[model samples]
Target chain A: GESVGLHLPTLSVQEGDNSIINCAYSNSASDYFIWYKQESGKGPQFIIDIRSNMDKRQGQRVTVLLNKTVKHLSLQIAATQPGDSAVYFCAEKTAGGFKTIFGAGTRLFVKA
Target chain B: DVKVTQSSRYLVKRTGEKVFLECVQDMDHENMFWYRQDPGLGLRLIYFSYDVKMKEKGDIPEGYSVSREKKERFSLILESASTNQTSMYLCASSSDRGSGNEKLFFGSGTQLSVL
Candidate 1:
């Protein structure tokens, strides 16, 4: 069975601090990984993605790190703001398949 | 801009009633998927279609069925809605990228409550 999960269910951060959300996956053959952000009443939005060939990928104010050896993935947000408060999820895809599995989301609350 | 739209933002249905959830994508994507978002469980794929008249069951597809008669439209059918089926349903589509790693574009989602 394939299981993707997060280390934390909820996290609270100050408005100006950085936030890091972690995920652990059980599928060793997963070749691609992605991070998504979902706001209240909205669907998940793609943040960043990294392939197994790459260890780190960065976007505007966001970074995703993939540790294939440990089967772990992480998303880091720099200078987190109030608007950044949402549930973050990490998804993984095994090669030679069209399916992607999402991890239990980590809810983040930003204090003003 | 890629756009995925679900037919309803909110729906209410009674137990044992048949329900239809519609999704339309304007981007002519080759792949469409239906997923349910629940607290603590994340997004669970219900079904997916790669082309017209084609569908494949996902991990949690036991009580659900799907239809994809047209390239831009995908539908989820619940033969007899149950209270357990109440959750946020999301629609997503992705363009064909021969590389098999294209990103998904998702709809705002439809929250359904079964009483």
Candidate 2:
């Protein structure tokens, strides 16, 4: 059974500090990874994504780092703000697969 | 923007009642998925359709069924709703151009409560 899991259930950071959310996946055949942010009562929103060919991908204020050897992935949010408080999840897609497996997610709290 | 729209934002039904959750995507995506999200359990796929009139069961599809009569519409059906089945249902659509590289576009989700 291939699955995706998060390292932490919750993470807290100062408003001006940086935040990192870690995830580990079990499927070695997975070729695509994505990070999603979900606010309370809303569906998960796409934040950033990375392919197996690339180790790191950066967005406007977020970065996704992937380590294929370790089957680990991380999302870094720079300059955490109050609006950044939400639940973040990591998802993996296997090659030639249609379904995406999602992690349990980590709740990020930013304190001003 | 790719839009996946769920028919309802909130729904309430009694136990043993049949429930229908409808999802429509404006984008002509070839793939559509239905997932249920619960606290600490993440999103569990119920069913997915790759094309019209074609469907496949997903990870947690024991108590659910699906219909994809039209290309843009996917429906999730609960034959007999139960209290344990109460959850937030999410609908997503993605293009079939890339095998595993397509990003999912999700709807706001429908919160269902069974009593």
Give DockQ for candidates 1 onward, in order: 0.69, 0.78
How many steric clashes between backbone atoms does each model show?
0, 0
The Cα error of candidate 2 at residue A31, in Å, is 0.9
Q: What lDDT tens digits, residue by residue, belong to model 2 across residues A67-89? A: 99999999999999999999999
* Tens digit of per-residue lDDT, candidate 1, span B1-115: 8899999999999999999999999988999999999889999999999899999999899789999999999999999999999999999998746555677889999999999
Number of the top TM-score candidate: 2
Tens-digit lDDT track of model 1 for A61-103: 9999999889999999999999999999999886657788999
Q: For model 2, what TM-score is found for chain B?
A: 0.97
- TM-score per candidate, chains pooled: 0.97, 0.98
Model 2 TM-score on a 0 to 1 scale = 0.98
Where does model 2 sit among the CAPRI classes?
medium
Fnat values, candidates in order = 0.62, 0.71
Candidate 2 Cα misplacement greater than 4 A, ranges: none
Deviation in Å, model 1, residue A7 alpha carbon:
0.1
